[model samples]
Target chain A: MELGPYLILASLEGAVTAAVLALTAVGLSLVFGVMRVVNIAHGEFFMLGAVIAWWIAHSMGGHPALGFAVALVVAPLVVGAIAVAADMTILKRLDYDPERTIVATIGLLYIIQQLTLMTYGPEARPVEAPFNTRLAIPWFENGENGWQMIWPWGLGTTSYKLAVIGAAMTVLLGVWVLMKRTRIGLVMRATQTDREMALAFGIPVERIYALVFGLGAALAALAAVLIVPIQQAHYLMGGDPLLLSFIVVIIGGLGSLPGTVLAAILIGLSDGIISVFFSPTLAKILATLLVGLVLVFKPGGLTGSSGK
Target chain B: MSAKAKIIALHGGLLVLLFALQFVLPAYHHGNLARIMVLASYAIGYNILFGYTGLLSLGHALFFAAGMYGMGLGIQHLGLSVAPALLAGIAAGAVVSAALALLALRTVGVAFMIVTLMFAQAGYLTVLYFGEYTRGDEGFVIQQAQRMLWGIDLSDATNRYFAALILFATCLAVSLWLVRHPFGKTLVAIRENEERVRMLGYDIFVHKLVAMIVSGTLSAAAGAAYGLLFGYAGASFASVQYSIFPLLWVLLGGAGTILGPFIGTLFMFYLIDLSSGLTSAYMLIAGVVLVLLTLFAPQGLVGELRNRIWRWLP
Candidate 1:
């Protein structure tokens, strides 16, 4: 059995897996950095994004490509607004107590999930693949072409997956620039590191908190838009990603961008590879056990603070 | 009235009311009442960790599931009698819990909470993956719980209700003992100030592991009984939604108080039962109620009631 084309297919699949997780984990890490709340409703925001994008693409009449673009950019902002409202109304009042915040977010998660169930019903809805086309690379085909590559560049292609990867890379680089070289970003970092000192210096820490939460929500929503093509839009979809994102965040280290990215890719690729070889159920068990073992031995995670 | 006498009277009144309800209500309601009591026992265990000890475990259902699966495995496949099966379930819960605590107790706060949740999902999936032993997601049904002793005729509703009542009472007794004990006091101290407790030379890890294991064991008993009561056990028992119930119960009743989880359990179950009868979306109501309770009555029903009564009497 020839394994060359199959290996390329595997890598592409793995890359898509890594990108989706990293996209979602980045938003979670950002939210944790400023607010310190785990945002249990984080997955719902992603769900909303997927649902909205699906609806828009189905309704836009002719070209689905434009619909995909609109979803990548607009859905996130819409979801971000929801996140801002939640942050302003619930989290803002909780005063950043981890317990209360966790409970409150969990409560919010249920509300959102139930609402989504009410709105979408119990069935999983498939989003239209904006471009329904595939290019087959001639590996060991008819004698004329020897391992010749087809058009659309490489062997296999899913426009949706490619779009997702491109969006994730753009988001990561954009966020890095925003965090590393912006006036408000400087104040936000200062506030996270030393809230009292920043407050003493007249920084509007409250506004920063709200903005950061909204930004994280938008990022999660963006990921949701990308994920829908691969996994479809469904109410229960949030449950899997929510658990996976938590694992990624823990593996990456709370509030560390580099750590989150590296951890997300590592976890996502491993999870993908395992799922390819075994049942998704076994993969989840193995991944979680690994995380649990790591916590037992190295509670700080790959790059987390060893404050204790 | 003296506070001790009042407290005793209040508990007595509740017990009497619950017993009376079994007679006054229909058979189904009696079963539900039994279930409420059974579930309350589980919640009481959760309160030990979340309420009194100030630790949040988002995956408490692992213990519940362990007990449930144990009972299912014992009766259906292993051919153990009901009493032995239930004991086996509790033992299973204890073992799994000890293993989980070894890893989970290492982290604290949000790390502990999320990691515990991850493990809970892992536990659920592991059971699902080992479809051979666990029957995969299809689940298994126990024939019936055997008589507690030789020739007791354990099939009647009255016997079941009494059994549940006895178990609930035992759980309450154990909870009370735990809270009042010196070890319980240390748990509270750990909650208040882990750093100071550490400075005082107490091994916080050991204390947390003990609390977690005991909590898991009691919850497992409830889960085992619940499986027998329902006559079925499935992976859903270990899901995060199941984990939420105990936390909700403790909070609704008034965490850090002896009567909190009991009251919370009763209110939540009845509210859901009644609400489900009214609309299909009972979960929505429960979700809303939990949020409102957390926002407005963070101290819970018992706490709020006590404050009101104190104000009125004075």
Candidate 2:
């Protein structure tokens, strides 16, 4: 009811959004940094993840937790395999030329979206959360009682939402470790730095590219799976994530993981907070224009990295 | 025949063929042809920037929508006649493109694409936000009474066909003239090597800006003409799908070729139309075609024809 509690509620929602966005944007940033190609179908991979999660959860005759657990592991792997197949079949043939990659991925986007529309149908379907318990949040008020903690009505979140945030953080941390402390990451980074040099050093650059593309797509799928319970799985749901991820990648200074995460949080939070003051559509319009202006004025992005 | 005479004869012959087809074709195909010509005009406009100037914008739909709304709003709100509303639509496109070019030109490559896409997204949202005027996604129709143009009943099938043809021909001629002119050649040269063009004492920014304006204005004209001819103006035309349509058409038809847009539009329209009859997932066909084209026929149909047979195809 009060401003403090409402702000807290919005922030919590924003945190969930930021968590998902960070994963998606980080996935995009990784692909862009390593491959120097934008995967326009990244969002479709996310949509596929959600749709597959729904299918898995729906088909498995067991407890919701069991189905969710299976979906959590399976969806990303399936999406990753698809990404690898696409990379090998299409992007590899094009030699990862920037313009051609864009067009090709756009085609991939259409195929994936249309196929989903055909099979999934054009309806939004919800995935039952593994466990959902509404936990009321306590707010402090400086009253006659002096800093009394009071339970506010409608100031609560589902246990599943909190778990999503925690899950995203753990996954993001795992990704960071994989990139920083693994040999495979070293090979990928080396390839990213100099493809010809990596080839000369016997890095098996093409395989590394395939692996990286798959890994990036897997990360996006993972995010989708995590969020699918809270947000319904829909055929057209990928557009927002795709646009938001694109904005985060650009604002975070293409390829910078830290920048991507930070930008995602900022954008995600602002999106939630802005909706409190303005119509959701107006907020979106403002955000889109803001991103355009940022790109126009600061091509290098806020992190001061030369994207080129 | 001389190359010059041959080029003229080829374009002239194509226009004549289109005109003659109106007389003999059935009503369904005839209507589809008229629609194709207008969309082809949009693709031609896209080609000016993408095929010729090497600037791949992902937001031509903004200009297209601007034109449609500009004309539609003028007639709906201000009660302006068809001709002035059409001019108003073109003017709106010019102004919007000029402003966008100034900002968007600062970025190059992928950033440029993203910028235009973002602006277009904003434009689309803006249209939805002002739903009272635009009628949002469910778009309003322009009545037959409002569809008259200077004593000509443009709502009539024959007149609509001729109007679309005239629009398509004007766009084709404009593109033809541009390619032949020094200015258009400079744009082509810039596409090949921006650095070299700049070294040759050309103002690269101004050239790109002008190309963007011309491309945008033509697309807007197509949008305006589409709304006028079809008797509808909708937010769907301003959407990302609409933006991608021109790109797909230009790519399929042969990006830089003069006749590529028409062929692409015609081919794609029929492909979707026929496929939709069999299954609802007709876009799957479009997706497959795009991927296959990128893989096997990167040069597109007209581009392949030029490479194989007609070196002077432009």
Candidate 3:
């Protein structure tokens, strides 16, 4: 109703986008960081997460929370397993050659997409959020009787939306701690720093790579699961996330997790605000153009060393 | 005595066979053959950059779409005759590619690829954004009047096939010459090792930029010819799928070889045409083939054959 309420609503929406985008982009960045291979099928992994969540939720046919809980755990696990299998079968065999891997992943994208289209039946299915408590937001109004607080009509949000943001932050914190403090994290960091040295030190680089690939995919899946309740799951829903995540990864610098998160927020918030205020097309154009500029002027991104 | 003469004779024989096939093959399939030839030209164009120069662009669709839409729209909107309109379309492709290359060629490896992919996607988005003028997804058509060139009607099916054949032959000859030329070898050298090429006192940037322009212009001409021959131009022409298709063809047939693109185009086109009848999951086959090809046979059918069966053959 008022400028304050509208801005708040837009930011809230933007926050949700940023939360999910951060998770997905972070996964992409991590994969790049360790493997040094751009997973073109990363978005497909996101789509798989959403679709599997839908399938699991739908087939369970019980309390929405129970289905959601199951999906939240299962989607990421299944997607992660798939990624490991793909990495071993396809990527490993190729020895992770940059160009070939891209083509292979492009093929993987097609295979996954087509399989989903065939089995999933090309329908955009919606999943009910575990909890959707509607809370009306109050707005301050300059009434004749001094400043007054009024519950604005339609100026409300679902509790699930807030939960998404909180849950994502929690997971992100968990990831940070795991990367910073854990033995596996050290191994991964070692692998990222020097694959040859990591191997020489008996780190089992191949196994770590498989695990990292799976972990990266799982993160993307988790994000998809988080957002699927708000946005319907569809077979062809991978392209936008893929492109946006690429932009995020590029802007954040390809291997920097913190950079990915930051760029995600920057892109997500702007995307949300711009789309709400103006046009989605304009938002896309701006993001793409920004990526081009970043590529030309700052290819290393905001956080990482000059890669190119 | 040399590989040059051998290649020339090989091409000459294939050209005769193709010409003879025109009569022996049924008339109903002429249009399909024509379509194959136009697409083959694109593969050849793609091969110059990817096969010869080792630049794998995901944005070749910009040039392809430029040619298709430029030619179709030029004739439709400008009311220009066929030849001039085709030239204009080709010029547009070269210009767009050169512009993109100026920016993209600065980066090498994966960055170059993703950059090109983004640009191609941007072009597709631009087409959609200006949907009113470009007709967006619905596509556009060339008028019959504009299809006439110097009293000869390009709208005629036979004429269209011959025109496409001529274009294919021209591209093939030019490609054959280029590959044999020292300039083409330089591109190959750059592909093998850019640093070495640079250290040899060569201007790699200029060479790469020129490769992009030449390859892009040919693709554009092929795109325009496809639109002119079919009398249709659509948004799909500007899509990433189109870009990938040419790459697939070039790779599948043989990337650097003159006959590779032709064989790849023919094989892939036929496979697709055949498979599209049986199932909608036909693209899965392509994806699998691409994966297998990339892993096992990066050189493609012709390249593999040349390596194994006949080193002297083109």
- Evaluation by TM-score, superior candidate among 2 and 3: 2
* Candidate 2 C-alpha lDDT tens digits along B1-314: 98999999999999999999999999999999999999999999999999999998999999999999999999998999999999999999999999999999999888888899999999999999999999999999999999999989888999999999999999999999999999999999999999999999999999999999999999999999999999999999999989888888889999889999999999999999999998888888888888988888988999999999999889
Model 2 chain B: lowest-lDDT 10 consecutive positions = B281-290
Q: How well is each residue in A37-79 modelled by candidate 2, as lDDT tens digits?
A: 9899999999999999999999996899999999999999999
lDDT of 1 by residue, B1-314 (tens): 88656656766676777777777888888887788888998998898888778888889899999999888788877878888989999999999889989888877777788778878888888888877887767887655444343554444688778777877878877887787799998999999999999999999999999999999999999999888766778888888889988988888998877778888988888888887786555667667766677677898987787687643210
| Residues A15-74 of candidate 3: C-alpha lDDT, one tens digit per residue | 999999999999998999999989999999999999999999999998999999999999
Segments in model 2 whose C-alpha atoms lie over 4 Å from true places: A142-147, A306-308
Better of 1 and 2 by lDDT: 2
Tens digits of lDDT, candidate 3, B130-166: 7877898898877787788888898897788789889
Q: Pick the candidate with the highest TM-score.
A: 2
Best by DockQ: 2
- Candidate rank order under TM-score: 2, 3, 1
| Chain A TM-score, structure 2 | 0.97
| lDDT score for residue B163 of model 1 | 72
Question: Against the true two-chain complex, what DockQ does each candidate achieve?
Answer: 0.59, 0.80, 0.64
Clash pairs detected, candidate 1: none
Winner of 1 and 3 under lDDT: 3
- Top-lDDT structure, candidate number: 2
User: Residue B111 of model 3: what lDDT?
Assistant: 85
TM-score of chain B of 1: 0.91
